[model samples]
Target: MHDVEAPPQERTRFQWWHHSHPTFAGITGFFAGMLFVTALPGAFVGVLRLLFSHDTAEQLFPFVLLALALPIFMLVKRKTRRFAQFMFVGMLVTALVVLGVTSLVLYFMVDA
Candidate 1:
């Protein structure tokens, strides 16, 4: 007599997404960085307003500079360096666009 029952298969392990494709990783990181650049200052200010007086919040505003260390840390690590590079480029480009638009608006408002 032969054994007819089949052995049970092993369950697959959970895998997290890392955006393995270069283009996908780059685009995801870039947009995420752009959003971070635009939203962080406002979010910080809002939180400060909620937690402290106007003068205190204004004085503490520069603390936002500390956030820069995150990307710098990401850059220092080989694992996240590629994504960080794209993120940095996105942040710079977004900042430039924001500054350019703001300056143009200020100039036109002053002229008018």
Candidate 2:
């Protein structure tokens, strides 16, 4: 009887990308998007206050966002680069849209 050889298994194209760059890029993008939508503006205001007037609650949001985004950004930035930027922008836009929709809903609910 002739000996039979087993067929080789094919590897997935995305396996390496997922383990390598794409993973970090996706994460950084998420945090960047969250920072932009939730905390960036507030941080800017907070810094302005430090530069000019007394501190206020408005500044806290930005600082919070920065604290949250920095470490996340650093971890992924070196890996994904442009992919992270795309993710951040897309997420930020989505967040703004949701905020607007929520505000509209609240306004109608209050009026009724």
Candidate 3:
């Protein structure tokens, strides 16, 4: 018996990001997008909190807007555009859900 090894295929950093088929691509992209969407902010805030006081961190929070450039770049590039679209959708949905839940909670608490 003999075993043969396959040569490694070369892929760009993001080339293998999406699954082969569209269906799985969307599903995986959605979750991956969600994770990437959350992680950036989480990391920024974590770093700010570690390095600065609350008021300073609050003041600097707006700087996080700069992070939007990454997705914008991804969207502009042809290879990453598809994945970036899914990431954009995931980010939008996450923001909406967070606001909706927060509003409902505040409404219930304040109105009661």
Q: Residues 40-69, candidate 2: write the lDDT tens digits.
A: 676677676777655465545455555546
Cα lDDT of model 1 by residue, 1-112, tens digit:
9977544442223223436767766897798789779899899999999999999999999999899999899999998888889889899999999999999999999999
Model 2, which residues run further than 4 Å from truth?
Answer: 1-19, 54-81
Q: Report the lDDT of model 1 for residue 18.
A: 39
Worst 10 residues of 1 by lDDT: 9-18
Candidate 3, residues 7-107: lDDT per residue as tens digits? 45534545556566566646655776677667878899999999999999999998988978887898899877787788788888877888899999999
Candidate 1, superposed: residue stretches over 4 Å from native: 1-18
Q: What is the C-alpha RMSD of each candidate to the true structure, in Å?
A: 6.9, 10.0, 6.2
Clashing pairs for predicted structure model 2, backbone only: 43-62
- All candidates in order of TM-score, best leading: 1, 3, 2
Q: Candidates 1 and 3: which is better by TM-score?
A: 1
Span of 10 residues, lowest total lDDT, candidate 2: 6-15
Ranked by lDDT, top first = 1, 3, 2
- Number of the predicted model whose TM-score against the real structure is largest: 1
- TM-score of each predicted structure versus truth: 0.79, 0.44, 0.73
Candidate 3 achieves a global lDDT of: 0.79
